[model samples]
Target chain A: MRADMIPLAFRDPVHDSQSAFRRLLRALSRPGTPVSLPGPAEAPEPMGGPLAAIALTLADADCPIWLDPALSTERVRRYLHFHTNAPQLADPRAAAIALIGDAGWLPGLNGFHPGDAPYPDRSTTLILQLPALTGGSTVRLSGPGIETTTSLAPLGLPNWFWPAWHENAARYPLGVDIFLTDDRAVVGLPRSTNVEVP
Target chain B: MGIDLAFDDHGVYSFAYLDEMTKRMIRRAILKAVAVPGYQVPFGSREMPLPPGWGTGGLQVTASLLGREDMLKVIDQGADDTTNAISIRRFFARVAGVATTERTGEATVIQTRHRIPERALTEDQIIVFQQPQPEPLRRFIPHEVVARKLHAFAQYGVMYVRLYEDISRLGHVAMSSDYPVIVNGRYLASPSPIPKFDNPKLHRSRALALFGAGRERRIHAIPPFTDVKSLDFVDHPFTVQHFESCCSLCGAQDSYLDEILLDDGGRRAFVCSDTAYCAEQRGERTKS
Candidate 1:
């Protein structure tokens, strides 16, 4: 794709970043609940609105971001680099934030850093691109933020994802937290949540 | 003359005071706090307009979290009109231009010090607690390095032993306020300075409770429906303060009251600590 073809960043950087950050906060606090992104961001080809908004809001010069093989294209790289100014990391394990564009071809959950017990806050935050936020296999989630049991149907997740998620949840205070993004909405699945998929 | 504390110098402060990057960092830390439930997430807490130990922690959080649409409510010791509350409310109104409210129900975000509202909160509400001390085991273990090691292993035996020692010496657990509670059966966390009477409300509540200790540079949270158990011995049991008389102003037997002395002659009067809640109850009673 041409360099000029890439869309510009948020119209109002301050308000836009603040709004998107709050939405992401609420999404992660209440797991599996989709929160709307600020008015659609100008995204490069293959990069959706939610992911673009998140990249603009969160990724900074201090944080190093990694992308899955499919999303490591020059266009996406240029877009993120130009917008967020975040360094691109080749090693998945070293990523502070990992953008997984293709969930079906995930290279296993163990590849990423889960942080140490003493400093569990250093864990990787996975931004997984999904087909849809709803209308798929329903998974019952129970944990912090969940009152009783809440059901979420995030579409296009791989068969091996749930088992991997169970192992991740078992890590407790040390595991990668995930954000599942569709076109314009994102839902969080924190490591504390116990997932039961049928 | 006292230092001119007025911010009327017309210096262009950023929206909400903190920059976008700092807000994003705090926002990320808050998410992590909620994820871990009780584990404190360290952040680069910034110096605010006010001095330390003066609700700066809560102010930072309120600043980061405030939006144009949010209705903010600030209270100190459950009173909305106190100096701390008024100053914080005024600061936000000037900085973020958010609407300020005294009614607990009307507020979307409530920044508090030393007390939880007497009125129950719903899911839409978020309570930001100004924490002077974030560490629960700081009293038993002064060194933070040692405390971190103990927390990593979940070695809370010393905390229980302290409670046991309190029973041995003081007949009952003498600690009244700043009661420690176990969050999600994981890390033992300080629920700020809210009275033990308000501890039960922390367990599986509908509202999201966020704690910020700016001086300590730590932030933690208790998400809605999270399990929060007050630390107690099976035999000793956790108990809240009880009074023989109801609130003199609102006739609230069920509310938390602050005892006041009328004069040196020992004339005593009790009133609800949550002034707004008390006024609301009085209004309702008059209407009925």
Candidate 2:
């Protein structure tokens, strides 16, 4: 926990969060892109590395957040409470944002609301903290949001996720947005974009 | 209990829960909503402490719009004290500390469930709906693949067929809750779960309406006085329902009512669906 909170420095927190946050906006605005955020901050354990940094970037009093119960602890909750006033959600489907350290046990993306064509932008954003964030071996990506057939070498993703994401993207404007974070950085692949696994 | 000031470090979490970047993204979405007028925009939703099917999305929009001078009102199915509504009201009182009201006339913003307030809402007021499912096509096809294409191209045959199917089966469209509507003749939007009975209130409404689905990560809007139509065929047509009984609790004839049972005798009673509106009307009568 101590390692995860070292970056909440008031003197430099705003400055550091600025660059990372700008990129998150860019990533969401245009999906299926890997934009690495600079992070040396200590993220709460389980959240690990860049994902934790992203948590700091997005958590706020405005958005309600939910996390896998296994990753939640008194200290971590306390830190998050102090950092982001975001209420803890009991149901993952109701949260505006969620953090999933392990994707194996997560529910399907379809349970989420995909906004209609007249209002097609309703969906959830999931941050899956994986063991590694590589774009080479585990999966290959190609779609509207990616530059040129990008690859996501994710570590330890459940077998069901790839096909599920394919189904999610099939919804076009209405699907879950994703962010995969590991020991070093974070990469996003929104449902508007497509993915392929090798 | 000692409050910790150490976590206020700027480097960790920014002043607001969302980094300026996330807020900017939301701000951009808001601008688009304004531009399109009655369109729902897909956004990246964050997790809140509350559940999804509840008012988390409305709370998010309320949180985003709140400041030092805002008065917030939250109601469920139009009732002020329904457990979930009370919970959300208490949530804002704790987190944002904005002023709260049970009077629709006094509130700057109202977060609501199924029904709109019985009292006419003003132009300055913004009503936010806690949407369980923002996608109108979701139940029709149950296939994301089919729903998206239909929506993108405005191929809403499934919805028409479903409504027609209801008319064929129930004689009057067996729909009672969360009726879907097309806003401004272009954007197909959900009116949340507010029964078709409330459909007339959507057309030319004075208030600015916003819809948010927390779990779905989507947000949409309706500018003041916009044209909103529930999808229906010309020959079949569409209509709203009004309870024949006045409230057994409040005794108001024009207001929406809720049906409550008394005991094992199957005895039931009707009450105002909008508790605050009921109380306010009673107050007006007493004063008169």
The sequence of per-residue lDDT tens digits that candidate 1 reaches over residues B38-147 is 99999999999999999889999988888888999999999998899999998988888788989998899999999999999998899999999999999989999899
Cα distance off (Å), candidate 2, residue B13: 9.5
RMSDs, each prediction?
A: 3.1, 14.9
Evaluated on CA atoms against the true complex, candidate 2 attains a DockQ of 0.04
- Give me candidate 1's TM-score against the actual structure: 0.95
Taking the true A–B contacts (Cα pairs closer than 8 Å), what share appears in each candidate? 0.65, 0.05
- lDDT digits (tens) for residues A38-126 of candidate 2: 66354455667566666666667766778876567665676667766678887776776778877766766665555555345444568
Candidate 2 Cα deviation (angstroms), residue B46? 0.7
**Candidate 2 lDDT over residue span B1-288, tens digit each:** 997777424334333344454654564464345334445576767777787888777767665655445678888988777898888877766655567877788888899988888888886677888888888877767886676566678777778788888888877777777777887556577888998878778776767677778887777776555677888878778877778899876689988788899999999999888887787766653111
